[model samples]
Target chain A: MSDFVQSLRLWFAPGRIKDEGETPDYRFSLANERTFLAWIRTALALVGGGFAVDQFLPDLRWGVRVGLALALLAAGVLCALRAVNHWVRCERAMRRGEDLPVSRFPAVLSLAVAVVALAMVVVVVFGWAGR
Target chain B: MTEVRDPGLQPERTRLAWRRTTLSCTVVAVLAVKVAVHDDITAAGLTGLALSALVWVAFLAVAHRRIRALDAARPHPLSYRGALLAAVCTIALAVCGAAMIW
Candidate 1:
């Protein structure tokens, strides 16, 4: 449908977010930017790590290695998307003079990383690659 | 009234952050090239290498623009254009990663 296509385009476009209210202090904005950039670095780590694993870990089981690589790539993309949302949220909170919203991402990210590491350990220790 | 507040070297910090981001992108691009070389000279791999190179160049250019804007004496507007560019590049790299993996 035309409507569906339009929405998809909007989703891909960065203009969906509008900075409402007054521009906050440059420091706050800069801090928000730094945070966003930091997350972006995390994203780079994920994507780059994914490619590295895919290239080097021929020893890993096909399904498991492929799945892990895909998971990491997906995670990196999600991080990029989420970084924008977080930056916008912070800016909004600053403009309204409201407390910045608490982000549960750290906890969730930690859990996810742990699970991935465990999966890798299983792959390595069990020698799933050869079988 | 213009919101007059001391930027107090904040812009410099922001510029540094942006540089760091550009640096990170460059590193990722190099890694992608390395991987592509390992994967043999295939179209997809070569495309990934080229795309990554383009992204790193774009990132550097955007960061340079940001720094130039910050140097202006007047209060400058901070646009999300660069951030969007960075995010889109990340997504593209993700696809490239998936492609190489598959």
Candidate 2:
């Protein structure tokens, strides 16, 4: 347990990864950096969307309003965490001449966003009809 | 063979990505501020807004440093710490946004 904790701390500590692997092509690193930034931006947009729903939709049913806002905010938080961890993983892979890490996060994130959009549509359509 | 520097403008593209992300972060901060002030300003609201502003500035500084670093002939890889810091600030800002809503 101590070993795992130490490794986790070292993984997160600043400047430790620089010495581990040979420097790969700068272009690949830059690309990875850009991808990380893109994910961060996506997270920010989701958070902003959450705040917008809560602030702009005063007439929204309280339960639905909080639900949608919390969903979006939660997604944003997960994306933000995923963004950094993936960035570190890719950078490490490139340094070690290994294959870039891959995962199903993009698909999962898409599904999450779609579900939120669908929920919004249902709430809007039904709420309008009820009014 | 004298390899060309920046053969595909990758550094420029990366720099622009940083800029765009920074702008989006700024937008989020603005939105948070609006929400914070939308209702009567309480001490907690003010504190949340202040923390969000601080996080935005920290992220901005990190992005700006990386942007400048990309101008080199071969931009150094982003440090692990820098990337983590950027991500943490972003998450903190999102938490602030959530708190404002509640």
For this target, which candidate reaches the highest TM-score against the unseen true structure? 2
* Candidate 2 backbone overlaps, count: 0
lDDT of 1 by residue, B1-102 (tens): 353434477767777877788778887888788877784698887887787778777777877887887764343545767667778888887887687767
**How accurate locally is residue A70 in candidate 2, as Cα lDDT from 0 to 100?**
86
DockQ, structure candidate 2: 0.80
Alpha carbon lDDT at A17, candidate 2 = 58
Model 1 clash pairs are none
RMSD of each: 4.6, 2.7
Residue A60 CA displacement from its true place in model 2, Å: 0.6
Candidate 1's C-alpha lDDT?
0.76
* lDDT (tens digit, per residue) of candidate 2 on B1-102: 255567798988988999999999999898888888887989988998899899989989999888888877788888877888888888888888888777
Quote the positional error of residue A87 for candidate 2 in Å. Answer: 1.0
**lDDT tens readout by residue for model 1, A50-109:** 877787788776898889989988888888887866766676677778898677887887
Q: Which has the greatest lDDT?
A: 2
Looking only at chain B, model 1 earns a TM-score of 0.80
Chain A accuracy as TM-score for every candidate? 0.81, 0.89
